[model samples]
Target: MGILDGMTPKKLIIWILLAIGIGIVLFILMLYLTLKTKTTSLERITPYKESLKRELVTLRPVHIFELMEPTKSNYTYAMSDTNQYYFQVLESETGADIPLTKLKDSIPAGATIYFEKAVNYTNGVSGSSTPRFFGTISYKEKKYPIEFVWGRYTYKSHPENLRPGFTMDLAPWNNRVDTTIYYLPRGSF
Candidate 1:
């Protein structure tokens, strides 16, 4: 009867013990905001750094003087400035004959005797230019072709005399090269 008509049972047990102490302080503030949002996401993240440091520089191949394959690969454009050099030797395993005087008096100006890959047809700059040195063939990955032979003569003058039976016949060398292309390292800019 309205708790005995506005009566007191000790004010209805002190309003049910102040509503059970505000529901135990809102369940301990919801378990302290769920453990402070998981320790602030495991203290954010920042530790593991070390970047930037490169050196790269290692290339080879550059041998010249050995021609014979021009029936129609295209040629004849000489005006005279003198600097031709386009050698491509890669046919020596045992077919016999490779004597151009055992390579003109210890050749080494840009020597690559035979790796097969040459290009440098010049006049002022029409196509292949920059650095160009040559050599480097792997097949799956690596093709540094550029044995230089544009206008010709990379710079040759030392040949006082030594032409002994210049034969050099590796059986028309042609190591099979469809396309790989890569020549840049004479000066490199």
Candidate 2:
């Protein structure tokens, strides 16, 4: 009562309106500043598009079938209790044996390999063949792995079981041909 004694209803209404207007202005200013800061931070973290293009050109393409084979080592029994699998040396299309140690050098950076047929067994019993694609990319003198599969049906299999240091490609949905490359961190193979 004492504080409002000198203020009429009209003055009180004007004061309230002014305070609201000031608050709205301050809020907008704060929002704008926050968004600007986030935008700048994002720009710093993302790679430049041009640099990515230049790096991609360094990769070479190889056929997966040429580098892999249906040997026992390449075969895996899905849905098995023990996750049992065998390891055999992969071979190139020329019938030359490709040692596991030479995989990194055989497929250079930016190289592509097509795995038309992969050996897989369902229920740890019956074998079914699958198709896959593989590639390698190098950035900053370090190689990043890449892989692609023919369909989603085989995508859910244990990718972790893949040899360390290799990358796999993934599709968003089952039966979709489009693929997105996924890179594993070092030692995540």
Candidate 3:
């Protein structure tokens, strides 16, 4: 009654549309800034691959699940020189594995996962360098590729929600990211 007392139906519609337009623009801008933050942050921290002087260790896939995410899911890259990554591998062979159904055609039948440990963990690989992890799958007489990130066990870390099962993560070897593949533990789908 006060503000719209003399406003026509057409005028009211125009105002509503304009408001919606502004809202959409604001939403897009916020999203852009959030993603940009991650990219910028990583750029500032050049990767120091040589920071860690030790033999590259190979770990077996102990567990597979969704990796942790940030509040805005953008700060995948934080910490200086290194980050405390949390993933798991069995101390002994548990006979655990993901059935072929879950692996789809990506992996051949009668294949087993072989972790290609990345040097991106504390005392593993130092500096911020897009932490990467993956491994190989043995089928027939040949070995195929699979993804596996090295990290601390979530139960021990007591940190973010890392869904159990499988997750496609960035597989950056050195500075080049060859592909983004699912990091799955040895088990059924």
How many steric clashes does model 3 contain? 13
Task: Write one digit per residue (lDDT tens) for candidate 3, span 8-108.
Answer: 99999999999999999999987665444231111112222221222222222222222233222322221111111322122111224632112123222
Q: How much does candidate 2 score in TM-score?
A: 0.22
Please tell me which predicted candidate would have the highest TM-score against the true structure: 3
| Every candidate's lDDT | 0.27, 0.31, 0.33
Tens digits of per-residue lDDT for model 2, 68-179: 3222343311110011111122222234453332233333334322222221212112222222223334344544344323221333335765522222222211122223
Per-residue lDDT, model 3, residue 13, is 100
Comparing 1 with 3 on TM-score, the higher-scoring candidate is: 3
- Count clashing pairs, candidate 1: 13
Instruction: Name the candidate that leads on lDDT.
Output: 3
Q: Candidate 2's error at 146, in angstroms?
A: 23
Candidate with the larger lDDT of 1 and 2: 2
In terms of lDDT, the poorest run of 10 residues in model 2 is 77-86
